[model samples]
Every structure is written in C-alpha cells, then in structure tokens.
Target: MKNTLIESFVFLFERELDKLEAEIKQYPDEASVWKLEGDIKNPGGNLCLHLCGNLQQYIGEQLGHSGYQRNRPLEFSARDVSRAQLLNEIQKTKLVVSATLRKLDDESIRQMYPEEVLGYPMTTVFFLTHLLAHLGYHLGQINYHRRLIGR
Candidate 1:
C-alpha cells in the first residue's frame, strides 16, 4: 500500500511537470512574464520558480536530505527567467523527487515528517500528498496565466 501511494505521488509530480513544460512552451517569451493586473500577482515565471523551490525544499531537503537551500522570497520575486532555465530547474526537481521517493520504504513513509508543515503534525506520506496537491494547484494557475496572457 505504501509503495503504491508513493508511486502515485511520483506520477502526480511527473504529470504536473509535463503540464508546466507545456504551458511554458505554449506561452510567448514576453507573455511568460506578464501579469494580468497589478494586484493579480505571480506571473508564470515566478510561479514556476515557486513550484521548484517548494518541492526541492520540502521533499528533497527535508525528506531526502538533499541539502537544498531554499530562498522562498526569491522564488516569488525573480523575473524574466527564461523558459530554458525554468525547464532545467523542473528537470532537476523531477530527478530529486524520483530519487527521494525511490529511497523510501514503508517504514520511512509512515514515519513522522521531520518538521511541522502548515501548522500540523503528520506522517511523511500525508505531507507528500499535501505537497503534490499544492503542486497541482500552482500548476493549474500557471496554465491559466499562460493562456490568459500568452500571445
């Protein structure tokens, strides 16, 4: 059961990565940086950065001990990052997630997560599913932002 659950999460992450890559390719270079309104924050580029940072920090560093140093603020603030750069980051994230999940056994998956996330205590499996949901949420936003602003 644990192995199946982990496999499902890996699949989710991979699917979201594919969606993100498609959105990036679909949007024009200029449009990738466009925001719908001044108050409507987080362009596709920043969202992509945020997603990569979020996964790398939570799963790679905390779970897999990958020593990823997350700059949460920079994820939201960076701008005009090229599609190629974003794609590269996505690929790296994919590798990290795959390796991390592959290393987990049933016992590890059921262990308490290293830290409290979102003000809650949970098992590693629960936290991973939460992160996967978060990824999908942002991936949807990126897709919509691209379609709305893309030329």
Candidate 2:
C-alpha cells in the first residue's frame, strides 16, 4: 500500500511537470508571466513557483527533514521568472519528493504529518494524497490559462 501510494504521487508530480513543460512551449515567453485583465489572478510562472515551494516545504522539509524554507507569499507575488528557471525548479522538486518518499518506511507513512495544513491534522499518507490533488488542480488551471492566452 505504501509503495502504491508513493508510485502514484510520483506519477502525478511527473505529469504536473510535463504539463508545465508543454505550457512553456505553447505560450509566448511573455504570456507565461501575464495574468489576464481584471480579476484572473496568479499567472503560470507564479503557479509553478507555488507548486515547487509547496512540495519542497511540505514533503521535503516537513516530512523528510530536507531543511527547505518556504516563502509562500513570494510564490504568488514574484513575477517574470524565466521558463528555464521554473522548469529547473520543477525538476529539483521532483528529486526532493522522490528521495523523501523513498526513505519512508510503512510505519513512517502511517504516522501523523509533521504539521497541520489547512487547519487540520492528518496522517502522512493522507496529507501526501491531498498534496497530489492540489498539484493536479493547479496543473489543470495552468493548462487552461495557457490555452486562454497562448498564441
């Protein structure tokens, strides 16, 4: 069960990374950083940054003790980060999440998550599953955002 969960999470992360790559290829470099007029909020570059920081902080640091520090606000506020840099961060995040999950035993998977997220407590496996869902949700948004504005 633990192995299955680990495999599924890794697969999802990979898919997310692939979608980001495709978005980078499809959208104009400037469009990648553009938020639509009015209340659209959060361009693709920020979403990519948020995804990297979230996984690095939650899974890598909290669970695997990887010593990552998350700057949550910066994840949304920073702008004009290059696609190459974002892709590189995504690759690094994949490595961190993969290494962290590989080190976990079944017992560790069943243990409580290291911190409260979304104002609740849950097991490590449960939190990881939630994080996977979060990744997919944002990946879809990025896909749509690219299509909505891409040339």
Candidate 3:
C-alpha cells in the first residue's frame, strides 16, 4: 500500500503542478496574472504563490526537510510578480514535491505524521492525501479566476 500510495502521490502531484503551471501561463500577459475582477477575491498570481508556499512548507520542509520558510501573508498580499517568476516557482515546487515523495518508504509513511494539523495526530499518508485535495481545490479556483477575469 505504501509503495502504491507514494507512487500515486508523486504522479498526481506532478500532474496538478503541471496544470497549475499551464493555468498561469494561459494568462495573456504578466499583468493579467495579477488582474482582480468583480467577485474575485484572489488573483492568479497570488494563488500560484499560495499553492507553492503550501506545498513547500508542508511537503518540502516538514516531510522532506527542505528548510523552506513560508510567509503565508505574503502569498496573498504580494502583487505584480512576473509570470516568469511564478512559473519558475511552480517548477521548483514540483521538484521539491517529487524528491520528497520519492525518498519516503512504507515504514515512514505509516508512522504518525510529524505535524498535528487537526489538533491531533494522523498518519503521514492521511495528511498527504489532504494536501492533494487542497492543491486541487485551489487549482480549480485559479482556473475559474482566469476565466472570470477574461484572461
């Protein structure tokens, strides 16, 4: 189960990250990635930041010890970041996630996850599953944002 789980996780994470990069690239221009329109709470650029921050903090730093320090506030508040930079972040995040997951094994994944995300301990696999869902939810948001803002 662990081998299958890890393989599945790596594949899905890569796929979603690829989609994320594509969504960001879909914007007509760099400025368009930061465009906020009616009823839109977060622009595409911020979503990219938030997604990369989440993955790097949880999977890269916590699970994989990548030493990434995430600034949660800046993920949302920073503005006008170039699309090139955002795309680069996505690519880096993909590498981190892939490397981290590849290093895990059945025994390690079965142990309690290092962080108590829900105020109680859960297995590492459970937390990783949750992370995938989180990524998907925001990926959908980025998709809708691009469409809504006519980018």
The C-alpha lDDT values of all candidates are: 0.83, 0.80, 0.92
| Candidate 1 to truth, TM | 0.91
TM-score of each: 0.91, 0.89, 0.95
Stretches of candidate 3 exceeding 4 Å from the true structure = 1-3
What local lDDT does model 1 show for residue 30?
57
TM match of model 3 to true structure: 0.95
What is the per-residue lDDT of model 1 for residues 11-129, given as tens digits with 9 covering 90 to 100?
Answer: 77888888887777778765455565546598888988999999999989998899999999999888777778988998999899888987887678899998997788899988888
Model 2 lDDT at residue 89 = 89
Ranked candidates, highest lDDT first: 3, 1, 2
Residues 10-85, model 3: lDDT tens digits? 9999999999999998887787889888888799899999999999999999999999999999999999998889
Query: Which window of 10 residues has the lowest lDDT sum in candidate 3?
Result: 1-10
Model 2, 93-144: lDDT tens per residue? Answer: 8889888877876677888987888789899988988888898888887877
Pairs of residues at least 3 apart in sequence or in different chains that clash in candidate 1:
none
Cα deviation in Å at residue 83, candidate 2?
1.0
On a 0 to 1 TM-score scale, where does candidate 2 land against the true structure?
A: 0.89
